[model samples]
Target: MSVFAGRYDGRCAIITGGASGLGKLVAARIVAEGGKVVLWDLNPEALAAAKDEVGATRTYALDVSDPAAVAAAAKDSADALGKVDILICSAGITGATVPVQEFPIDSWQRVIDINLNGLFYCNREVVPYLLANGYGRIVNVSSVAGKEGNPNASAYSASKAGVIGFTKSLGKELAGKGVIANALTPATFESPILEQLPQSQVDYMRSKIPMGRLGYVEESAAIIGFMASEECSFTTASTFDTSGGRTTY
Candidate 1:
């Protein structure tokens, strides 16, 4: 651990949804390991709070769903941090819980906009810098729901699945370019986002997990930290599962 402790020493990272949840924990890990971090989140208040909590180098209150905003924020982050070696796209939302037939059209679109399209926007804006430097790591947060397609969560599942596909394509394109892209498919984690789901739906999800427990944000941060480090070489266009035995593939 001592030898690997400073893996990110001098590296800089951009973490979306860093205001809370796994993203924030990732930021803490990077910072703890001597990396500079720029936190991006839609909530200004949460961003401020997270800055204090994680000792982030900078914080941007920007909506990743908007391409223009994403582009601007990307530039700002690069400028502020000097260079961004890692990008963690954890900014997502779990939209309404309703069957496809009864799902609200607005809710479906919103989930797609934030979870999928927003991810694309961030990746598009950041990859350029990585290309110029010829070095980078990208970790997109997906979910087990995407792989298994949870009932009554069509929007969430579909959006996360899109992330998995998009990440694979991006990784292949960057193959041998000193950049690696991958996605993480995690089971239900203890986070504020869980409040959006109905208790019944949450229970159903937990029942499927052989571990009989929700994932901890710290556990996810640890995996993500490794993925963002130079130690994670030779892996790209892959999906790493944090599903507690729920997904064997």
Candidate 2:
């Protein structure tokens, strides 16, 4: 048996932003560990692709920022897979790289909507199910920018900082309730999200890392997997950093 063998056997999990990047990686790992997964995403094409890869029987197309949609998705997940044992909120946007004063209101709002509000919606919907089952694990994907805001991406920084605060409060509320919440901060990761950004912004991000390279998606997924498993029992309301030595983590 592997080190994580039998760890998530028979457990049910929900992975938002599950269609790509770190979310997709982590979802695959959870399924490989004998757990059931409900993949929630907004992109039909991406969702369909993931469905084909992970099986259509386990995916749902929905926006994480929509509370009613998220609640319904959770119900669908629970009804089909039994109950939610773990949930990973990994959907987010880096938004436009600019000073806050110069940032477009719409752009800044978009980041907050998905990165912070989406997290709130998912947790809001899942908490009841976890409370009912008396067990759950929640992992929110944050960023090193959250710990120390960057110069040109105030929206991304602010949104991620909100995630850190939200996770900590949720963790406190779920204390001793067999439900835990934590955030993961990854800096300059070599993930698909970077594909959407400009070279200059990417260069700026890469320059901040003490390790002198972008972190791998697989490495981030591994840490997320541990936090989702029963092995992460002692940590909650905490920020797990994977910044390649940037921001002191």
Candidate 3:
């Protein structure tokens, strides 16, 4: 029940989308465990709010989809924290909920940009610092939709699937080196991100869960905390399911 408490002592983490939702929850957990955290979020207001709420060591207004921005922020964050030990690529958007044909081209591009490409940017920019330190825990947040494509939500599913593939390659590339990479496939959880979806889509997703209920922020954060810790040794380039039994694979 207390997997996260004091689990991250001495570690430093960078959490994208740390201004709200699961990202914020994970930052809070890491801080509670005495870990140092630097938050990267696009929303200035939410970034300020999260800094106050989570007590992160530093906060940067970052747009992860922008490679240059991510690279610069990575340098600034490392300069501020002295080292980058963990990375949680949590910033993303769901885009529009429409079928492939009806999904606006712009919407699809935006989804891919923020969810998949943005994740790439963060990982690429931060890995150097991790490699220099020779120790790191990287957690990329995917979703059940990545495993099982959802109806009328092609962009989200594709972006998340890309995350899984990217994490796998990263894990392999960093294997034998002190850093490890993994992805989280979580089912619908109670968070502000839910507001982005339509009620029908939300209900459909929840219905797929065997537990007949959505997951909780703490539950997601627990798995993430473990993944981001030395305790998660031996697991790399793998997907951890927090899908309430919705993912049997």
Candidate 4:
């Protein structure tokens, strides 16, 4: 039932955080469109379940924050898939909800490590494979919080902002090489990540969306599907907004 049927024919993708939420949803779309995918996630059990659910070609228990692990997984994925055509970085956390002054230092560091540094490692290791093929798509998930900093979510916002900046730089570097990189800035979405936040925090985010509701996973996945396809050929090094009108700039 995919309008994008056959759009991904013969393509192979590596999706971090492919175990659930947006990552899992995106994997389903790619599979429905005739692409093969290799999933990477921190939870082996979830990874296994996701692979079965989405019919992924492979799964790797990965901690993107670990540079060595990311590197090894990248090579293994390429070896297994023959080539990697797309990378969807959706694995992230909201961290503890608290004012910047009260934010736990450890929590802040953890958010930055996983949300920003981890993404950097994945991109660095995978770009070589993409460059070798001279064709690739990278979609790094950011947040509306990144564009307009949210109170009590400083770490998440800052890390996502870094994602935007990093993706911009990478897109430029890969320009004219047939490889493209972009970032996704979505407003608060109805996701498992919301469970980590207090209800008050979630409500605050929901209130910011002019659409009067949180975004659906499918809605975000649709944009990602397009961004990670040949149709996105000319729009490299840019940020695609999915903020439900919360971010118009």
**lDDT: which candidate is best?**
4
lDDT, candidate 1, 6-56, per-residue tens: 878999999999999999988888888889999999999999999999999
Task: Report the poorest 10 consecutive residues by lDDT, candidate 3.
Answer: 1-10
- What residue runs in model 3 are displaced by over 4 Å at the alpha carbon? 1-5
Cα deviation at 114, candidate 4, in Å, is 0.3
Q: What digit string (tens of lDDT, one per residue) describes model 2 on residues 140-206? A: 9999999999888899999999999999999999999999899999997887788768899899889
Those runs of model 4 whose alpha carbons end farther than 4 Å from true positions after fitting are: none
The weakest ten consecutive residues by lDDT in model 4 span 1-10
Candidate 2 overall Cα lDDT vs. reference? 0.86
Per-residue lDDT tens digits of candidate 4, residues 19-100?
9999999999999998999999998999989998999999999899999999999999999999999999999998989888
For model 3, the local distance difference test gives 0.93
Residue pairs that clash (backbone atoms under 3 angstroms), model 1: none
- At residue 38, candidate 2 shows an lDDT of 83
Residue 187 deviation, candidate 3, in Å?
0.4
Worst 10 residues of 1 by lDDT: 1-10
